[model samples]
Target: MASCIFCKIVKGEIPSFKLFESDKTLAFLDVQPLSRGHALVIPKHHGEKLTDIPDEYLTELLPVAKKLAIATGAVEYNILQNNGKGAHQEIGHVHVHMIPKPRPEQGLGIRWPTQPTEMDKLKELHEELAAKMQE
Candidate 1:
């Protein structure tokens, strides 16, 4: 956490264009924005991933993101959060991106690689997950 940029931002060790802040969360303009009005919402708690954050710290995360989206006057946008490096999370902290999609070419563009649905495999997987959830 001492070396984390987000943690530094939260601590005012690194200056940021802060938009909103609460005890549990912080919203600021992204320095390397994907599009206009792009912002980063992060929990004040130092968490490497979603599951690492406490529930109390997470309570204001989405609400801050929603506020950022509305404040940006974004008609279309992407609320993005990635976990691991393979998932495209550059920072070692939990943060959500509110990227305003002003045009088709801008903001977060995603490609959904769809796979063929196999009912038997899907049922078996679902049952396994369901049983785990009960435990």
Candidate 2:
């Protein structure tokens, strides 16, 4: 993926405020940051979605993300991953959005409208997901 920006960053062809790097992954400050320590965690290998990466790689990526969140003094954080074009994934390469939510007044403010799901629906959805996990 020569055209991918994240690949370029990983290759050192593009400059990034790099925070951490491993053999398989790179963590860097987002150029267009939403907050003081906003960062993007990406795989060294180019992939368009989470499922594209092997399970072992994903296992390694999460702990690094947690370390980054703690190091950045994030009181709360959002781990956002967009899968496709319809989901607003502007970058062609897959990356995790590590948004540090230090305060409600700072960073990206999300207004989540809560709607109560029916108990029957919740039970059915849970069962469906649980079955998938067992497979």
| Per-residue accuracy of model 2 over 1-135 as CA lDDT, tens digit each | 998889999999999999899888899998888888888888887889888887655665777778889998898888777898997788988788788887787677666789989999999999999999999
TM-score of every prediction relative to native:
0.96, 0.85
* Positional deviation of residue 32's Cα in model 1 after best superposition, in angstroms: 0.6
| lDDT (10s digit) by residue, model 1, range 46-105 | 999999999999898888899989999999999999999999999999999999999999
State the TM-score for model 2.
0.85
Q: What is the lDDT of residue 68 in candidate 1?
A: 89
Best by TM-score: 1
Q: What is the lDDT of candidate 1?
A: 0.95
Model 2: runs farther than 4 Å from truth? none
After aligning candidate 1 to the native by TM-score, how far in Å is the CA of 94 from where it should be? 0.1
Clashing pairs in 1: none
Best candidate, lDDT: 1
